[model samples]
Target: MAITPPSNRLWWKEPIHGIELGWIVIAFLWGLFMFFFMIAWHFIGEQNLSTETYKVKPERYQERVEAFAAEFQAQDADGQPLEENGVPVVRPPVGGDAYILARLWEFWPILELKKGESYRIHLSSADWQHGFSLQPTNINISVHPGYEHVVTLTPTGTGDFGIVCNEFCGVGHHTMTGRIRVVE
Candidate 1:
């Protein structure tokens, strides 16, 4: 008599049952739905501030910053050139662009904005990496010496917002503070 080998496949390895197959299909479809939903919300449904940014030599970027400061000098309530929190201030006109310099331990030129106006704020580091954190609203932007980081913001509330460097640069890192005032 000839001996035949048993089947190589286990019984459980047979084609999946209809109920199990249906569950797998449903799960796969749900995953696809979630993926597409996230894409739509990020690209369309949110107030994303993806500003137009580009790379430049640090020296070149600094030149632009100096020119911007000379152009939009800010003044205090007394009609004198303003100095907010001990740093120079720049209150650009409505619908205009603004610049802030993040160096070793200071953010040069505090920003003053209209409560309901929008601005294109460009930031760059003159020395090392820094973090631009605006309090109350809790907005953060990365500042690098050779790259320009741009962001758009419209202050809905009138108040003074604090700017802190979240990156550790040196001994005075803890005191690297700046401010922006939103007025009516």
Candidate 2:
């Protein structure tokens, strides 16, 4: 069709069709409803992102994680060291603090926890930002250097939960993975 303007000079002031106006109003109301729903969900939703964070030196955080791991290092059934990918397996006491330090290509000190018990999990990064993604349960969060993010978690099931770094950090990002083993 040839490009042309409405013959009437006052076409810009013409009233919109009733059907078109109704659709516009419906879309506007839907957007408003969704915007308010997100705010309300923060108060009533079961799965909510935690906002508890503290500023800390990455070096200091690393030291704390190392000490925590050393205190609760686990041993194998045959009296050998229990490890995952060369990282010691630590079993923190129930209702205690569990530290996870993320670095270039690994999360140090594999964690072992008891099912149905809560833990204050502290996560931080040593060098750069990383993603704390707990598989199966799908608790994903960002871990940044010099910031300790605390999240209270109680494992509802027992198994080996994989922690994958969803945020790419470096060339070895693909090899960055950790483990959390929960027992009954």
Candidate 3:
């Protein structure tokens, strides 16, 4: 009986030296392309999106309130008046200007508002960019120097909400604080 030796397999069929290398290279290039594509999308697509900055003046609040009230009144006679959580909505004086002279380490009079009443706050920085933060609930916002920031707030419960500056402004940035009283 004669014994025959087995022939070596082709490079394409061999376990470690086959077409697997080509597949690996293709996978690696595809992964690189995907990574770069994602990076490009992040830079190009995200850069075009606009951030909203709401500005308000002392006089605009009254005008807006009156407009809102008029709209509310025109809706229905027997319908509920914008009451949230069973609390009546209180509208501030219509078409009246409330002056807020921005100062360091102080918040003019500090507001006391009724629960469920929508209050519009017209904020602007006189000196520099200031961070307005209402605490416990942790509502933090930014006000640019010479630019106005308008925010509407309605407290759900009766409590003392502290308004603190979260941004570094000047020497008294740490001492800058205020309070909002939410009544029954």
Q: Which pairs clash (backbone N, Cα, C closer than 3 Å) in model 2? A: none
Error of 1 at 157 (Å): 0.6
Q: How far is candidate 1 from the true structure (C-alpha RMSD, Å)?
A: 6.7
Q: What digit string (tens of lDDT, one per residue) describes model 3 on residues 23-137?
A: 9999999999999999899777734322334555534543454454444322126765644333223334333222222457655434556687666566666566788777887
Residue-wise C-alpha lDDT for candidate 1, range 25-118, written one tens digit per residue: 9999999999998888888877665766778787888788888877787766797876656667887888878888898899887888999899
Per-residue lDDT value at 63 in model 2: 92
Global fold similarity of model 2 (TM-score): 0.91
- List runs of model 2 lying over 4 Å from the truth: 1-13
Which candidate's TM-score is highest?
2
Winner on lDDT (2 vs 3): 2
Better lDDT candidate (1, 3)? 1
Give candidate 3's TM-score. Answer: 0.49
Per-residue lDDT tens digits for candidate 2, residues 117-162, read: 9999999999999999999786999999989999999999999999
Per-residue lDDT of 156 in model 3: 85
lDDT (0-100) at residue 30 of candidate 3?
100
Candidate lDDT (C-alpha), each:
0.85, 0.93, 0.59
